[model samples]
Target: MDKDQQNRITYTVYCINAFAERYRLTAKQAFAYLDRFGGMAFLEDCYEAEHQLSIIDAVNDLTQVCRNQGGKL
Candidate 1:
């Protein structure tokens, strides 16, 4: 990959790790929530650009799904 692509990848990883840390989430929980929403790559999109509430929205959506499935969120 080019230098720009490498930098972008590194930045994305940093941003996602920051978000997970901010929420006090384990990497496992963070990935699970993303996977549950069929959005395992959701972080990459937001990391590439500025995001408003999409990540939170996704977590909320995943929460609802878990609740409906009789599982704890």
Candidate 2:
């Protein structure tokens, strides 16, 4: 992959790990959550908004939406 793509991949992985650790979830589960919500686009948004948005905040938002939609974590 190109440098930019590689960077994004690395960033996403970091975010996934952060999410898993913070939520006591497995990496797979964290990835599933992101996929269920909005996939890489969601991660990208989080990365872009890092200055204004915390990862936990983003995950919380996703969790709330999932719960509202009758989806279990």
Candidate 3:
């Protein structure tokens, strides 16, 4: 993959791990929750802005986005 693609993937994985930790979920669970609740799409669609924020802030955004989509945590 190109550098930009690789960077996006790396950032995505990092966010997934961070999101998992923040919500006390395993990575697989985190991915499933995100996939179900639209957090994954939020991360992809907003990657430019989201990547500029701290990982904590990014995960907070993920949580809110997921919660808004009916996620419990």
Best by TM-score: 3
TM-score of 2: 0.62
**Candidate 3 residue-wise lDDT, 2-42, digit = tens:** 99999999999999999999878899999999999999999
- lDDT values, one for every candidate: 0.53, 0.69, 0.94
Question: Which residue pairs in model 1 clash with each other?
Answer: none
Cα lDDT tens digits, model 1, 9-71, are 665455445545656887676556546654345445544443344555545544554456554
Give me the runs in candidate 2 sitting further than 4 Å from their true place: 45-73
Itemize residue pairs with steric clashes in candidate 3. Answer: none
Model 2's number of clashes is 0
lDDT of 1 at 36: 67
Give the deviation of candidate 1 from the true structure as CA RMSD: 5.3
Candidate 2: RMSD to truth: 3.1
Query: How many angstroms is residue 38 displaced in model 3 relative to the true structure, after the best TM-score fit?
Result: 0.4
In order of TM-score, best first, we have: 3, 2, 1
TM-scores, in order shown? 0.44, 0.62, 0.96
Model 1, residue 11: displacement in angstroms? 1.6
Tell me model 1's lDDT, rounded to 2 decimals: 0.53
Clashes of 3: 0
